[model samples]
Target: MSVPLILTLLAGAATFIGAFLGVLGQKPSNRVLAFSLGFAAGIMLLISLMEMLPAALDTEGMSPVLGYGMFIIGLLGYFGLDRLLPHAHPQDLVQKRQQPLPGSIKRTAILLTLGISLHNFPEGIATFVTASSNLELGFGIALAVALHNIPEGLAVAGPVYAATGSKRTAIFLGRYLRHGGNFWRRAGVADFGQPGFANRYGGYHGSSRRYYGGALRR
Candidate 1:
């Protein structure tokens, strides 16, 4: 098979494995989730800075100004999506209670999964494009993307399991974590965190979630 196809398949399979482990691994420890997410963040950060950006700069006849502009645009675009959506990362949720209200929990879980999936799409594209151009670069992108996706899988599974107390629900959430509309809905929850009494009513955990989420956001 062609390199692109091979890379795509490998990436997809890695994502599936991560999701499976997140969903079925019988009450995954918080530390495991945190470390997985952290590792993923490190991989992505390294690849983006050390590989993808430099490779983009190397594109023949591609002006440094244009490349920088595109890089800025990509950063902004990712930020917008993260801010405007209820994206999930391993550290974004905390055990506020033994059980959150059933409906609220379900909604949050769905939103989290959607956010993860939206985030994953661009990663998939990046892997595809980089691999199409250069095999080594593509491999690096795939590794980074795979690392990042693991925590996303955990993010999706954790809340779903919490809400429904059902492994199936958690797995299902993990499966659909990338769906767009779900992210939009979760974004509404995030907006509730802004000024006004709504922020109090909103589900704001302590800074741990923020730290982990910020790491993934990077």
Candidate 2:
């Protein structure tokens, strides 16, 4: 299998680690979670600004207006989607009465899972493109993605376990449902990278840089 595919899968699989933490009733200290997330954000910011954006503009025939324009679009798109998604913190979901209503809890879990799953599709694409274009940068992007995804899994699984009182269901839905979207998107990108399309088109690297700038606007 390709290195890009392997990295994408490994990154997506980090969600399982968070799922296990959720089912086991263990939460990371807030300080540690904050530090980890901050580190991941730093990595993405540096790569996108220093590496991906520069590389994108350097591509032959790429004008400054187009490159910067796409970057701005990416930033705007990220914020737009962020506002549309139904996002609730884990504390918000579980900090209510000791015995919250089961139906409400389950509904929250399902919405969280759907929102996260939908979000993962774009992440998968960015991860795949970054890795395929530059293996070194790909690893960094994958690590950053994996770091954030762990907490996402915990967010999904914790509420499910609380509502259903079943570890198996919580883990399955949290790990697979959230990771499933990522896996399929990566697979689809992999097909695009096959000899037939990427090679014939010969614009893979340029396209990768453009997509990376926009898709990973964070």
Candidate 3:
């Protein structure tokens, strides 16, 4: 497999690490989780602003008007999706009253998995494109993505395990369903150009909205 594919796989696999932790009922301390999340968010922000956006704007024959326009569209698209989705934030589950109904927790896990899968699809696309263009940048992005995915895994698995008391089931759903259509979409990477304006800018804006939104909700 190509290095880019390998990076993508490794990043996606990070969800398993989180799933396992969640099944074991051991989460990273809040400080550790917060630091890791903040660091990853910072990396994504730097890459979006300093690397991806600039490179997209610098492409020969790329008009400045269209470049910024695409970035704005991406930003707007993220917000639109955020508002429209029926996602259950991980924090929402965590903050629920103690000993909630098992059926409710199961339903919440399913909904959360659906929401996380939607988010992961675009993230997969962005990771593959970034890695294909620049191996170094791709590695950085993969690491950032992997770091955040841990909590996502925990979010999905924790509730499922609580509802069913089955580690195998929880881990299976958390690992596989979390990726959803992303695995199939990986093949489409060949159809894309080398990390262009639309992909990078959109991914950047999406990542910003996801991270910032989570922060605001907390």
> Which one is best on lDDT?
2
Models ranked on lDDT: 2, 3, 1
TM-score of predicted structure 3: 0.80
Name the candidate, 1 or 3, with the larger TM-score value. 3
Q: Give the Å shift of residue 5 in candidate 2.
A: 0.6
lDDT per residue, candidate 3, 1-218, as tens digits? 78887787777778778788888888777777788889888887776666666766666556667666666666666676677655653454452235645587788788777777766655666667667667897788789889988878888887788787778889888767545635643644544423464466545433332332232122
Residue 109 lDDT (model 1): 70
Write model 1 residue lDDT over 95-130, tens digit each, in one string: 324645568777877766656666655555555545
Instruction: Give the poorly placed runs of model 2, Cα more than 4 Å off.
Output: 90-100, 190-192, 200-204
Candidate 1 clashes: the total is 3
Q: At residue 182, give the lDDT of candidate 1.
A: 31
Off by over 4 Å in 1: 13-15, 25-31, 92-100, 178-218
- Which candidate number maximizes TM-score? 2
Which lDDT tens digits does candidate 2 get at residues 1-218? 78898888888888888888888888787877888888888888888888888887887766778777777777777777778876665444362236655697788788878877777776777777778778898898889989988888888888888887888989888767656866666676766656567667665566556666666755
Question: How far does residue 59 in candidate 3 sit from its true spot (Å)?
Answer: 0.8
Question: Which regions in candidate 3 have their CA more than 4 angstroms from the true location?
Answer: 88-100, 178-181, 184-218
